[model samples]
Target: MIFLKLSYISQSRLTGLFSLVILWTLSTNTWAQKIIRAPYIQLAKSNSVLIRYRTDQATLSEISISTDGKTFNPSIKSTNKVSEHTVAVSSLQANTKYYYRIHINDQVALGDSSYFFKTAPTVGSKDKISIFSVGDMAAGETQRKIYNAYVNRQKSNYTNLFITMGDNIYCGGSDGCWQEDFFNPYHAGPLLRQTALFPSTGNHDYDNQAFPYQQDDSNMAYYQNFTLPSQGELGGIPSNSEAYYSYDYGNVHLVVLDSYAWGKDNFRIFDQENNIQLNWLKEDLKATKQDWKIIYFHFPVYTKGTYDSDVSGEIIKLRDYLTRVFDEYGVDLVMSGHSHVYERSRPLREQYGLSSEFSPEKNWPFNSSGRYDGSDKSCAYVFQNVEPKKKGTTYVVNGCGGQTAAHRFNWPHPVMEYSLDKRGGSMAIDIEDNRLDAKFIDEEGEVLDQFTIFKEVNKITKKTINAYDPIELKASWPGPANSYVWSSGEKSQKINLRPLKTSTYTVTDTQKCLQDSFEITVNPPLGTTKWEELIHQPFESLEIYDLLGRTWKSIQKEGFIDQSVMDGLPTGQYILEYRLKGKSYTLKLIH
Candidate 1:
């Protein structure tokens, strides 16, 4: 009986082991079936959002992206599987919430209820926002480790938007390499939690496509991963096929182009016979009019190291043809990377090199402005006229995001102003109505460099323009030493004071310089005071004055007594000092 029991136990153990093996085999098959893996995923940069991811296989049985955890529906047309089986999610609503999932054919592979994205707003949207961008990335355990620092910096800061200036991964750079090099590093970071990543293609991006060489591959990974805006003026390729695209943010418009496309068939960027990209660029530039315009690409036109100067074939061709266009319109700045260094050019053009107004003897016509303390910062020979001209666009190359290559500091561009090649860094562009400021920040979040691009409002050209006779006020009081006080209680940028009340306020400080008194008068709000009730000389108009004998302006039945004005004025000291009751009644105006 004991021997029979032992046999039964042994049989049970065999069955259990067999069941475990079957379970393991099924799990392994499921993992292999997934075409995409290590998805270093992100949304787009500007107003649009592009989703990027890498796959584990060359060709998948089937692949699709679906909203949240929903099943893929072919009729929706939202899913796209591109070259190398990579995918991009595009054409989403700006400043909104979205959920998504990935699928391999009909089998749902990765489903997370929390996978979400928010698109940026179009121009004039008036949305306060946050964004991020980095450049010069590569594959390595070191890059992987630094990536965590990047993710942490992003999570705890004001970077809601993300942009990558190519070189996202550095495996041998295939779809498989991107999985290992790019996505695997930060696949689980907060930056991925909720952010959009706008990526520009770099030289390393086209490493292994069917094209003859790296330059010829056309960045299949970049195109496959990000779904870019295709419908607007950025034409040349299919709407979705064109690597170049534009998106608006508040009052800013950003145009992203594939620099490698212009990088010459035989390593020559400027071929008159093959002007395909140049033509497309002209059309694209003529199409947009946001308050500020910024362009991003891989090869920089101005740099202090590596491929410096526009003479580097591609840079020269692009600069010669495109710089004029950017100036014709109001492009605020242009940004590029791939130098493994950081450099900034002064606002430049054919005429102005570096200094705007300061004219040096050598550069003859174009001289730096010598006006501001004679420091020679003006790139005057380029754009400055007797009157202020629309400023030239400044170009910046912030390529040191990550790379094994080092920089040699010999700058070549005549307009180049600042250059640095050190540890990795990033740039932050702060945009507002009046100005767009670019700040270069290092990995440690220390500000390495700073520059401001002041937006110049172009002259209004119209058949008939509405004009206002700027409210003018005149005051003449005692000598130069006399202290002069005016009403409205605020200091203005202009030296001459102008008041709309037609009344002037003047107070003399005997301890100050000379002051010449003029026909000064103060009037109360039309409704607040009865002008006819006040008695005065027949032809001489009556006037009112405050405690310091300054005219308090009043017009159109309203006076400057809002909280702002009242806050500074003394409450018990002010008076309705009008000659109504035969004499001026010193009435206290409450705060």
Candidate 2:
């Protein structure tokens, strides 16, 4: 270190020397550690996330991050010298947004306000989750447009995670293809920077120029580039292998299967009995208790797009085996991308036959459009554990993320309710509580098709009322049910009726796919019953009804209700009934 005498050094000279030193240090550090690949997020969880990037040469990597941009904490990690850098930051708050910047040799490599990530909501939290998924999205003009459409749709509200249904890189599926096709398009937007990736494998992703064009994971660029949560890292059974895995986000459980023969001695998803991949899938599905289970892979179980599911080799196996598993486990959605067209089937089960053999009466229980847009008979698919459990899986072939062309022969399978050909689009799924919305948004930001699914609806109820007494029944599903029809000829969710005698009333949604029944029994004028009135004794059960026999108030095991409980009641004649000592009592009360 050289120091000039304070008496001889002028202020101007001293300032100039300090500036020169700072500039030199920054320039050297930046030039030495040139970032080859921008930072991309991976394996994000409720409290942690992994960031991976590549540099020109081996250098120390550090991250400066903060919840609010006003302050930041730098975590100096990766002391080893390496071109590829993976930095993990932990102990973060759940479902929080954070801004981050990569520092190479203590110099800023990439950072901005837009460079931020939001953690996944707490594992089982009911927070609304938005997911974006695409298949066959090989980087090209159409791919970029689809990406832009998503970016435009989500200006500030970014997806919690993005999933690729395989075939991410086109052509040879080498490093060059990944750089130009995958990174080039993603780096131009906030998708990779802000969203964690969960990708499956496709046939083209295994293409390699090396000996044996279909190379193993060791030589496959697809495996080498991704850092998957393979070991129950994101809330699922430990898969150990990247070939296929499962993870949870909010209340959704997503399973990404490697349909292509690439893992464990090249065992494909369609292998015969005791297939390793299918075995793991069965175990995982059995273990997870999540509200929603979504399975995605490259081979579609039902499609009539570029490839016919009835004739395709792997799809046939998937249909024969996977449908049973999906139906057994009550899987909500099964997605795949290989046909280069869009096709969505009605909620179906056990239709593994050829297209000509499809029987809607047996295979598809919910045959509505499911658009929920007021179109003819269009209503959301409302599911429940009602008597005659109508648990079915909706199959989607979202293969038009990159390229779309003329559909194959018999483009729309008999099971499909909607089909779109020659349209490049991406799938956006929003899940909150029991309601899920899925949309196929075209490259022009137009929602070509959409549908809704509701879970845990009660299809049956029972009540006893006096003759000519009215009772109110409410629909269990959310949203306005005005388009529905009830046995009373009412077209709304809540309806009131006074049945003259014991009878059952039924209500059906607009699509006629959902139905609810109420069994109301008329009690033969309980006013004439002979029982000791509970004047001062606390009753075990009590119900108050107006002259119309409509239940105004009801309670069980509440001990007693004071006059204040009737404050809201109108001044009219009322009937109070109570059950005590295993006996019933009725009194005419005038309010």
Count the clashes in each prediction.
Answer: 57, 2
lDDT of 2: 0.77
lDDT of 2 at 432: 81
Segments of candidate 1 deviating more than 4 angstroms: 1-116, 141-160, 210-219, 233-240, 262-269, 351-390, 412-414, 456-524, 527-591
Off by over 4 Å in 2: 1-31, 209-216, 387-389, 458-591
lDDT of 1: 0.48
For model 2, name the residue pairs that clash: 469-548, 469-549
Which lDDT tens digits does candidate 1 get at residues 1-591? 000000001111122111121100112132344434433333243323333343443223232333444653341221233223223334445555555555555555554655656555654654545545566776554355445555554454444456777766655567567666666555655555456555677777776665544332335655544544454522222222234556565666677766664343343233553554555555656666566677787777656566655336666665556666666765667888788777776665443222233232332222343111223453112222333453566777877776634555345445655667656677776554544556666666666666654332222211211111123433221112223343444332113432323343433222222222333233442223333232232221232345454665332232322333333344343333323334433333432
TM-score of each: 0.59, 0.75
Candidate 2, residues 365-444, lDDT tens digits: the string is: 77578898878777788777763456689999888889787788876888999899999999999888778899999999
Global lDDT of each model?
A: 0.48, 0.77
The TM-score that candidate 1 achieves is 0.59
